[model samples]
Target: MTRRTVRIAMNGVTGRMGYRQHLVRSLLALREQGGLDLGDGTTLWPEPVLVGRREHALRAIAERHGIEQWSTDLAAVLADPSVEIYFDAQVTSAREEAVRQAIAAGKHIYCEKPTGTTTVGALELARLATAAGVKHGVVQDKLFLPGLLKLRRLVEGGFFGRILSVRGEFGYWVFEGDWQSAQRPSWNYRSEDGGGIAADMFPHWEYVMHELFGPVRTVQALTATHIPQRWDEQGKPYDATADDAAYGIFELEGGIVAQINSSWAVRVDRDELVEFQVDGTQGSAVAGLRKCRAQHRSATPKPVWNPDLPATERFRDQWQEVPDNGDFDNGFKAQWELFLRHVALDEPWRWDLLAGARGVQLAELGLKSSAQGRRLEVPELSL
Candidate 1:
């Protein structure tokens, strides 16, 4: 058995998602597990070169993680011949140019979604990656979540016979920075910085719906900036220009309708921050980040909707919990492993740059649909 190291230039590690999920949980976790076994007797180890704007932050992360390389120079990092892959978790506005540079440097690409702020930019990245013949992919981590995995299992096992509609509720209250410091960055509320609920989350809904049910044919949406004022990281008051909430109805290829309400302003009443209730002819399932519960048609309880008397039915207890048949890894790490295998061993992988473009397209169309106050058709995209 032979072991080889794959040098990955990871940008945007200073950000929350990038620092916590991608860098710490995913890549470092893989390293702790003695790297990934590549089936063909080759162990693939990841060596990440942290790239970001702030030298102090980068150095702190590198030193804390015992990572040898931390760089403020993206160009120099890209010029290094040893770097086999480039991963971006940067702000949406900054992603395209960096990715383009990575593609030009003959590096395989992997990054967070809303690959670009616009569909055109995202598609251009896809085309460039394709032309460069670099193995590329986008983070579709939600698909690998325990609940979604269970949902996929149920779907595959024909538990959800003749699947119908899907209802999703996602988001929680983000504190306005004046009184309480916001959990999310202040830039998330600024439209000029490529921030908005539609652009941020519609890409996720797109892949989730498309992969689980079918491709979206049309989209109808209404977006809102529920909170117009917030404070930045420096405690300075700023106008919140981005929409904090989005209500969307997506028409799928198989006549399935998916309605999703995404909002950062709304308080979370559901078990998870994000939950999806999928109904079908045979059964219905409600899935969150880590848990899934289902009720088959035969086991579903019938409740009277009469307001004359107090409701007595224990509706929540009716659904049976979906058992974890196997261990589930961190979704980001799981996808990273797959992408690594795809890059190293030519493994058959479906979530590529083109798929990412579709996600960006959905976001674009979603915002457009909201702006137009009408349903918009989603046309097929090509490279």
Candidate 2:
């Protein structure tokens, strides 16, 4: 098979995710990891063209990567005959418009989540993309994580029989940049800029929640802004309008339930990474940020609820860290490769904008449930 050198056009190549996920992956594949393969030992990586709003930044990035082509006009890049795929990692508010324009340009689309702020926008994008007959995808990085992959293997192998419930804890304290000179981009704390814990993270949980267990049936949630102020990249203070923390409970298609607490304000005292605890009628498993544990029916524990118990005492003896297994996990980079392969050859890729729209659906439901003080059932999409 002749290796397809897929030419990629990238929008927002200077943004955080655009740089880390799209450009860095290109750098690694071309310079370090060696370009992608089609499993049959044929390379699939393409020449990448970086595009951004600023000409100087785009030129600098292209020079840094030893890439010659850079563009400030998205329309010109879209019209470029050499560009096969148009990838967007732009802000949440700009995703739909960029994707719409890309679709019209007859290029395949690969983009970030929340496809848009609303489910309707997301679904409409999907419809239009389908009408244009373009291959589209959204990044669901956790599905490819090694640790989570192991957890998935366990579930598929029936390690946790009669699966009962799942508990997910995710977050880390993002400093407010007041004392030690803050780091995170200020746009994240601004709702107008499409930054918030809910908009940023719901897509991840939507994929993980379904992959780890099953489809979400209903959700009850509340959002909070722990830190009301933050400094932007310029060190100027601004009022933080987006939610920094969110708590939600969702019921799966089966009778299974999941509780997820996501935050940008909470510091790690227990697990430093996102973790899941799955309990089944026959057995139970605890998946840590970087590790996992299992307790089978053979070793079912006997304990009583007590008021004077230490925080660490409950699951200590019952939980043992799952083996690192020496398997490397590329959280987002792996997903990038998968999308690349899908573009090169028509391989099956499950993470798409419709899936992302489902996440936006859940977030909207969460907000509705919070506003109405009730649990809201997630209506299935037309697909």
Candidate 3:
């Protein structure tokens, strides 16, 4: 079989998600597996050139990963004729311009969600990519999770006769950095640094709701900064201007209502860090990050609400656990493989820059809803 190489200029490798998920788990793992089989007598090998702002950090990552090329010069990487793809996992605020540059350089572009800080910027990037005729994609990793996949299967199989509503609970307590070190970066709590629960999480919720149920028609949100102060990685006190928690109500097409709560200040009591409960006329299903359970109408136990009697129904045991009949790859890796195929073979890809722009639109509208203290309509994007 003929082997082909796709040179990728990967920016922002020093960040946590960029380093761990994209580079180490996905790209490196794929390389270790002897590259991707194109199914056309050729294999596409991923050759990543790590790009970052710090030379020491880039050198360290290269040394640890056994990478041959590491450079702090992003312009040089973009200018290199051998580079076919430019992937960005940078902060949300810095994505648009870098992606624009990559598209201008005639490279396929892929990046993380909330493509830009504003919906306009995100849409502009999409327009530019389309004008440049570059293959562009954004990370929508939640749709590929094991639990969500099972839920999708249930939906596709018509397990829910008439889908009614969805309730999503997501979050875990983040240390305030007073007595304990903060688990998240200090920038996450500062609005000036493109940090906020709504901005970071609303895009994920938007895509999930849109894909699982339908497009969002309207949204009502309330956001708050529960912890106002925190210490940084340098052990210095700083004010947290951005919100840490957000409670939102999204009205989807077909009259499906979804209530999602995202936060960094709440304690988790669910089966997983993130879970979604969907109730339908025929049955109900609850899906977490890795597991899904369903209770059909026929098997659901009848319960009478009475204050006079002690409850002994054992509600949690009634649901049947969904089995993983096939191997489930990491969400990031799965998307990465798909993007590679889309680029190499001109395969159909639905998760393009425009879809990513919709995510950004939802987040921006959510913030507006919270600020205005009312439900607001979500307009569809045209470009």
- Candidate 1's displacement at residue 281, Å, is 0.9
lDDT of 3 at 190: 95
Q: What lDDT tens digits, residue by residue, belong to model 3 across residues 344-366? A: 99999989999999988988898
Model 1 lDDT per residue over 131-210, tens place: 99999999999999999999999998999899899999999999999889999998889999999999999999999999
Q: What is the lDDT of residue 351 in candidate 1?
A: 95
TM for every model, in the order presented, reads 0.99, 0.93, 0.99
lDDT of 3 at 169: 97
Regarding lDDT, does 2 or 3 come out ahead? Answer: 3
Candidate 2 per-residue lDDT, tens place, 280-345, comes to 987887776456777888877776777787554565677655676676546777777778777777
What do the candidate models score in CA lDDT, each in turn?
A: 0.95, 0.81, 0.93
Model 1 lDDT, residue 83, Cα:
96
Error of 1 at 356 (Å): 0.7
Q: Model 1 clash pairs?
A: none
